[model samples]
Target chain A: MHGLPANLEEALLGLVREKLFEGGATLTVETDLFAAGLDSMGIMQLMISIEERFGVRVPESAVTRDHFSTASSLAAMVRRCAAPA
Target chain B: MKALSDSIVEAIFARAAEAPERAAFVGRDGEISFDHLVADVERWATVIARLPGFPAEGVARIGVRCPDGVQHTVLMLAVMRAGGCAVPVAGELPGDERSMLARTTALHGVLSQGGEERAADGSERHEIGGGLRWERLAAEEPCFPVEDFESVCPAFIRFSSGTTGASKGVVLSHGTLRERLDSANRRLGIGGTDRVLWTLPMAHHFAVSILLYLREGATVVLPEGSLAGDLLTAACQYGATVFYGSPFQAALLAAEASERDWPGLRLAVSTAAPLAPETAGAFVRRYGVRLSQGFGIIEAGLPLLSTTGEDPMVVGRPDDFELRLEGSGTEGGLCLRGPGMFDAYLSPWCPRQEVMADGWFHTGDLARWEADGSIRLVGRLKSVINVGGSKCFPEEIEEVLRCHEGVVDARVRGEEHARWGMLPVAEILPVDGSSPPTDGELSAHCRARLAGYKIPVRYQMVRELPRTASGKVRRV
Candidate 1:
């Protein structure tokens, strides 16, 4: 499966791990971030962090259940929004 | 001054007759004029009157599933006009949960928006105007003996947002509801010239805010969405006079980089949750309008309102209610006896006399009366966690976690945090010796169904959680 680019995924996962899972919780591409303790506020913070890191503004309309479902999903959203149109 | 009609339906009709062209509610669809509202309410009332088993003897309790919109307001009024008690059901509830609510309330019928009406019996569904669907379900089951809502002059029934215990329906009579509106408007002074910018869910604050605004001939403005930009655009475009929102919304508005000021906005009242000092200050700094904190409870309508933004910690003085502390000190259980107090609890059927002691309703909130007569809320007697001012009961989160396939058992608790007042943390036992699901998976499961504040911030795999002798998860 064509998932997020390896480097981008690593960077996103690193941020997720540091901000969301401070207790060294392991994560996978298919892992559900919400069930892993990433809440709505955490999602907002993650969006802000992503915006600052990738220079991509996550529009409010794009903030839905699908966009932040998993690590892979979030990475995909960032890639899609950050890509040159 | 002539005595105002005790019934909200009568008052609406009077207002419609007085000024037919006045806008009662303004939404994305368009403004619903009082004349149109009354006409539409009457049309829906006629449809409801023809429905079978619509309580031939007493007031029928009908469940309304319409979310925050113009149609919801119309449907609620129509239900009341049809001489039935309107019970608002959250549209986001799962099918099973909705059915549970229906059974719990022993509803005569259910009016939903844009969905096929589920029926256990061969009841036919009718398409009502204003994007509403109705079904008569009372005939399928024997009706439970409900209190005579008409006798008590009740206008609506709202369920408590409590997640820990069984949800109890708070019955507010028409008289009490009107009194609440009057008392709140005494402080707010909303008039024909005032246009309120609304953000909170309609189901939660309809009686205290929306109905009150409509009764006073003020216009209610519905934002496109909860986004800070959407709210700002609506407020500025519509010339919103008053902006009512929660602390979360305030924080979002504060965070947005847009350097715009809503010149028409006069007052911004925050309720339905606590207002954080930082959020209040940041919103004032951003919008150049002080965020006034209002202390409102379901049992007792808005009794205290902070008019001046002098102290963020103080929730202002009580206007129409008598407040007393159970124990002497700076802090104690905040108890109040108010004009718009709830008439009764539906399930288990506790009358006001039984629930209230010595004419005072003990608000579970722990608060301190300052030397200056201002009250500051300290904590809650109940184990409800306040996440960034939003109350989330751990029991609800624990119940949601237990529903996960990989979870065998779960216990949720609130951990005191610096930013958000409290953050919900969960400990889970994996099923069948399987590895516990990653935090991402659990949060995804929760975020899909539950509200944002209810989602846990931390999760840990544990063999067992501390429990009392009766096997209740010990919150303390």
Candidate 2:
């Protein structure tokens, strides 16, 4: 699974906007996933976005942190997944 | 901090060396032989041992994010072989959950594919605790061999779905690894010539049988896409004989196949959760495949083909473990014991005495023995939703609703109610393209199927029920 990093980031942002936020416009790097009302089930929608965006496997354990904590952490994790090893 | 036992990794190597040319792995990318796979593991093993922070001694637990396909198995086996425990992951979790489990476990190292553009220290090492990636670990490289290794050591730790709390790590013995592996192999009827579709996630023990597949020279089909279509397509494409899943996975597969036909399937083995009698019956009716539901957990070795008789609720008899019962009512806890079972949970281990009274590990499942000695699981004792002490089991309600003609799936979770304290609520998926059954119709249907108290007080119809990757309905 290979793809562009910027496109991956933009795709992730678009996903948070469309699937997560409904383009309501409040999502940012500092947004609190839990406090913002993104429950575990809602986090699953984010799981799909990361998978679709970077084409990498994010384990269920990852569901607890890095991705769901904040927008910046989520983006960094995604960028890591999208970044070529 | 390395919590796993040692023999698990040795078994992986033993299985690989036994079948060098056999199909060790199958992913969307392609197939690989056990011989080539071992070379890569050894190369990484050598690299891991010398890294500054990597554990060269003591019981060390490591996390690895393996994709749906490719040879993440190689990296894991290498770790175990080098006397390290392999913390298997779903490889599809979000970053936060991934980091949480990593930090919770404090994995010494991490192995991931396609994550890092460059290493933090410019070294090839990838930290497993956080999403620290290195540019070199993903390539096709051989793992270097460790000159000195501890054969008698912990391999990895697994999370147990606790009866009353969030899941905790369960420790297995490298001491009993071989015995456990053998029991699973015997039950699975696995061999080198038999190709296994690695449908279960990497963290599960059944993947230990992957070694058996290699020994027999059989190919493995590792699906890269969604597990939704992978099993069916692989059943036809790989001629999968022993299809494995939890009762829910079996039910979903049967439900999915209800609309189609699957002729290539040979054996349908259900574990993790008890397959409902109706779920089993439907699969046999549609595909003519008998659903083999059994019981398993991280602490105890998963036994095979346990059932009192032909009933799906009858989880057969324990092959490698022991069983016992406590309490009464339509619900009670099912306890188990045997050699392959772990002695106790590492943390606190306080509940050990209660759970291990009389050499049996109380499984906390509401079950009973039938006339023929088969175990019947009603549901989890703790999973009950308390509505002002009018105790209710969600599975019973969901089971009745799932039987509705227009309902393909249903989930019953307890929701906050001002007056009731907690009330049973449901979410449902209609059968095929038809409209979901009306709430009144469903409530009436449940009235006939369950006690008046068990009837759902509220419900909503939707395109699909929320489920985990393994197909179990998620409560929260």
Candidate 3:
């Protein structure tokens, strides 16, 4: 319902806020999601959300600790996944 | 005939005695042989048996709250083997929900690990090894009929997800556990040679998963973490052959970034929620093995499995069980009668005979019979949201939302999701038109009361909620 996020990183931050933490968390582009309590279930939810929202299917092999550490890191992966093969 | 308590304990020990050096559990800590596993379990049982107010001839209800590991398995097995009933208190539950479970189940004590925040009131704490501490609560008479509960030889009490008030928890007996394991293995054919890679939460899946693997003398591989990378590394390190977990985990494994393949994997079973066809397809393409989605009910053990791996929806024919439909049509409420059916429902105290008075347990799942005599789940008759594999009822979430000071009334429903199966969203009617509860406030309120999975992903302000003719909230 709200206006589309300006960029991919902003959009991912929005998604993380709404889905993973249920809008109760204060997050930024560089916040450590794992330190903020992002768990295995949260990772799965974010994976599916990325697929559904951005039409990006993050490969299983791409799910690494660095790629999932922050919103910006996830945004980079999503951008890569969205680019043409 | 041996008593139910002795029978299960003897069965497990007998396996260890036969192959003492066989690895029973392979986790991050290290591999534990069957003999060491049995010895550790016996040590915990000795501690449990000496707890204050432990009944000599009746069952003592003890809650086990721990992360999924060998310690969790040993404690639960110890509780059951020591002639007590084990109730798994999931780690994700908030304090309020935890207290509600304790009171409703009438747990005599709780064993917690990792120095959890709170212990039951009026309880004494004793330090158990492996970071586990047992809190012994003051003796109190149970609200339910204790005699009826003890008569069934209760082994485990699993609180049905989102259940509260009268329809509380499902009770599984020692004998019923044995029967269900036997029936499930008839289809699985798991033996000492199979090494199962375990990822699902032990609290939600112990009855049919870890217990079955241990009883069948199979080695269980507990991954360091549930990530795809961790699972793959564990599988290779432990030489795992069986992968039993939810579709979410399967999806991750399918999309795993590593070039390494799980060549030793013989069978992979997906359960807990319906599997999306894409996930099934991708999994096969990735690993050259089909993902067999199974239909596992807490009331009835795993009765149906999709062995052919053709249609993920079509759960293969019932094994050692009889299935039927509630209506004459092809698609109707699925019902079944078989071994491993739960012994009773705890709070309102309904026995198995009363529950199966009609000779079948209505699964509340809408299903269709395929031409090949397999079963395909169409939908659900109950208003439940399966977020990933965990289930939460809309009514329970609605109750929590209504308690918010800014909300007049609320309605919750499951929204179709691409990955998690279904995610819950809420519509709220505010008490004052001028002001409404902020999303952050509502989220914080719910986070303090419910599990993380049960919290709604989105909230919308509405003037009115759709209702039935009788004025009750009409569910879609």
Candidate 4:
């Protein structure tokens, strides 16, 4: 629910664009990841990449359709999870 | 080979009574014991019994919109226990498509997820427990009187995945379903000692696999997430013996950098899509297990299986069905006739006789027999692309494209070319969005795996390909 830092959002979008979409796909922070063909497997790969890169663990409960709806939303969730409790 | 009950509900009850404390299904949320599963089924059956349109005697057809997990499994069993045919509708379907299925099936009621129940014009609504709402729709218009097919009692009505075009309901009777489970189990050898790691949507494969697993008293483990790491962990932790997944899932697993051998994995079966030799080889190389393929059709239940896993392309021999190649040479239309075939089609209420010609169901698949007497699937007849008097199968080309490291999924279709009758064009989904192989790189990869004529002339990279509710790429 917390917003992601500007740099973090850019990094997350870049990762998604690279891993889930083709280089030719034009992705923005507002672009719907699911609409762009981000399926369950894609989300899993994204979560793994995010964890490896940012050290944030996304709980299974946090992996709903809404959380991964867009690059911005996913970045926000990743940021929230990564923040100190 | 044993004396199994004809009714799935009866089999479930028997298993529950035999092993009350045994785990029936293990999901991310929690595990359900056989006793708990039976109790849940009874409670939902009581709710169905009180529904308005549920018939007092005969089997009532009801639609269910529930996600794939313990809840969906329970609800389906409940529908069967209540003497109704369970129609499993995908929860993610658009409202229009859902309503169309309800209308076409002439469902007596639909049990959908969420808190509240609303009924429009000709339907009445009631709230069932467990966040499920039941609505009774008006009866379908009388076109022809409903007649029983071969005196077999109907149990489940499943709509085709509709990867190619319009979906049709394939009705399976209780007897037919039981027969399918028995026949497939003989080949699969799943039993009480086995635990299956399930990932495919329950709605798409319930009758053939999930229901069959339960009937055979095997434990089913549903992974918490689709992550390859999570699934591999679940399979190892739960001691899964059999793994049922799609080619995409297998590719993901093959890509994961897991060092430990998946200790308990005895069998890995791929369905719903073609199994690329690259995928099969990678999985076997990574895990030391062959990824067997099964050629399953909604009309005929799991007729062929690669039990030996010797050749990934060879789908092995028929179990219960009598398979025949209808044409000549190495390529011909695959036709089958067997027990446990679909009893009827829902919309027009056409009997099986209407569709069958001399007891053979002409599956739209193009296949050929190997020298070893196993059937190797070429592709779907409708998906063949002819180029300059030569023919090629899209599945063959797509498999080559998928073998590329940068490609995640590929769909090949024919384009109208002025010179060649039809030229094959491909839309590729990159493995990771950042770097996809260029057209030249993909062409080179294809050249290594396929003949020159089979390579796609053009390639378009996309983020994702359109898919059906069942997760197969929708070829439009």
Q: What tens digits encode model 4's per-residue C-alpha lDDT throughout B1-476?
A: 11225668887688768878889988685888888888888888888877888877566878887767888888898888887889987643434346667777777888877523232235687766677788888877534245563255778888734222234577788888878877777778888888999877677678878888888788999897665677888888888999878765776677665555788988899876667677788889888888888877777787888977767668988757788887667789888887778887765666778878577888777899888778988756676564432345677678768878898999999775432346678999998777778866776566544434455766888988999999988886
- Candidate with maximal DockQ: 3
Second chain of candidate 4: TM-score? 0.77
Q: Which residue ranges in model 3 land beyond 4 Å of their true spot?
A: A1-38, A45-62, A75-85, B1-6, B53-57, B119-123, B160-167
Q: Supply fnat for every model shown.
A: 0.03, 0.00, 0.30, 0.05
| Models ranked on DockQ | 3, 1, 4, 2
lDDT of 3 by residue, B1-476 (tens): 11434456667788788889999988786899999999998888888888776667678899998878999999998898788899998876777788788888888889998744664566688886667787877767787899999999888999845222223689998889889899999988899999999888888999789889988899999888778888999999889999999988898899887768998999999998899899999999989999998998788889998898888888999758999999899999999998888899987789989978999888888999988788999888878788889888888889989999999999999898876789888999999868898876787788777877777777899999999999999887
| DockQ (0 to 1) for model 4 | 0.08
Which run of 10 residues does model 3 chain B get worst, by summed lDDT?
B159-168
Error of 3 at B42 (Å): 0.4
Instruction: Please report how far candidate 4 places residue B130 from its true position, in Å.
Output: 2.1
Report the Cα lDDT for residue B132, model 1.
65
* lDDT for position B223 in model 2: 56
Q: How does each model score on lDDT?
A: 0.73, 0.57, 0.84, 0.73
Q: What DockQ does each candidate score versus the true complex, computed on alpha carbons?
A: 0.09, 0.03, 0.34, 0.08
List model 4 lDDT by residue over A8-75, tens digit each: 87878876654454352578988987667565645655765575457666654466556787878887
Docking class of 3: acceptable
Off by over 4 Å in 1: A1-85, B1-5, B115-124, B138-144, B148-150, B160-166, B387-392, B400-408, B417-420, B431-434, B437-455
Q: Which stretches of candidate 2 lie over 4 Å from their true place?
A: A1-85, B1-6, B92-100, B115-152, B204-218, B255-264, B307-309, B327-331, B349-358, B383-476
TM agreement with the true structure for every prediction: 0.81, 0.61, 0.91, 0.71
lDDT of 1 by residue, B63-83 (tens): 787767788888898888877
Docking class of 2: incorrect
At residue B271, give the lDDT of candidate 4: 73
* DockQ: the better of candidates 1 and 4: 1
Two-way TM-score contest, 1 vs 4, winner: 1
